[model samples]
Target: MIAQDIVIRPIITEKSMQDITKKKYVFEVAKKATKIDVARAVEELFKGAKVQKVNTVHVRGRLKRQGRFEGYTRSWKKAYVQLTADSKPIEFFEGMM
Candidate 1:
């Protein structure tokens, strides 16, 4: 898959924000994408950034009920990308802070 396809979007949350200081960023990635794919995607999407490690989590869909009807939310994959010490941080996330 292409780099943009591999990385859907950045995951910005209170917990994710805390990780930013450690040079770690989180993203919503394609379910079929592997750790290596994520590492490469991040490097290609964010200039001047080097991925040191990639960690993934498969979040199960949660069941929701609206009155009598019930359905499950969409399941998705999350990637935690850690950058090298000397690498520059992702400017996209910096702007959110």
Candidate 2:
């Protein structure tokens, strides 16, 4: 898959945003995307923010049943990107009520 298709979306949460203030950003990424790909994508998307490090995790799908057949939530990858101290953090969602 192309780099554009690798990153699904940023995982925006109060805790994650707090992390962002400290130079970390979490993202829900494609299952097959590697750390290098994630780092590159974030660096590109965030407009020159230097990527200090990239960490990826594999989250297993959860099994569930709704009074009938069982089903599983889709598995996904989570990436925690650390920005360089000199780089500014990205703020796509801020100042919102």
Candidate 3:
């Protein structure tokens, strides 16, 4: 997959923003994507940045109930990307302020 198709978007919340400041970043990736895919995607999106490490998790959706109906939400994939020390950390929401 191309870089554009790989990284859907950077997940930058208060939690992740703090991480970015600390040099660690997290993202919500496609459920079907693997660690290798995530690394490639992150590298591509970050423009020549090298990924030091990649951690992926399979998130099971929680169940919700409305009235008498009960159903589970869709599961997703999460990736924690650690950039090399020499590489500039990813900046998604940091520039907003």
Candidate 4:
């Protein structure tokens, strides 16, 4: 998959924000994308950044119920990308903080 297609969007949450200080960023990724694919995608999408490691999690959709109806949320994948020490931090996330 293309770099842009492999990485869906950045995951901005309280827990994720805490990881930013450690040079680790989280992102929502395509279900079929591998760890290598996510690492390359982050490097390409964010200039001046180099990925040192990538961790992925498959989050299963949780079931929800309303009255008598029941359904499950959409399942998706998440990627935690850690950048090399010497590489610049992602500017997009910096601006957010």
Best by lDDT: 1
Q: By summed lDDT, which 10 consecutive residues of candidate 4 come out lowest?
A: 37-46
1 or 2, which is superior by TM-score?
1
Prediction RMSDs, each to the true structure: 0.6, 1.8, 1.9, 0.7
Q: Give per-residue CA lDDT, model 2, range 24-82, as digits (tens).
A: 88889998788888888887877868999998989899999989899999898999989
Q: Point out where model 1 deviates above 4 Å.
A: none
Quote the lDDT for 55 in model 3: 88
TM-score of 1: 0.98
6-97 per-residue lDDT for model 4 (tens digits): 99999999999998989999999999999999998888989999999999999999999999999999999999999999999999999878
lDDT of 3: 0.76
Candidate 4 has a TM-score of: 0.96
**Each candidate structure's count of clashing pairs:** 0, 0, 0, 0
Question: lDDT value for candidate 4?
Answer: 0.94
Query: Per-residue error at 30 for model 3, in Å?
Result: 1.8
Which lDDT values do the candidates have, in the order given? 0.95, 0.82, 0.76, 0.94
Q: Which ten residues in a row have the lowest lDDT in candidate 2?
A: 88-97
TM-scores for every predicted model: 0.98, 0.86, 0.82, 0.96
Any idea what lDDT model 2 has? 0.82
Model 3 TM-score, 2 decimals: 0.82
Cα deviation at 29, candidate 2, in Å, is 1.3
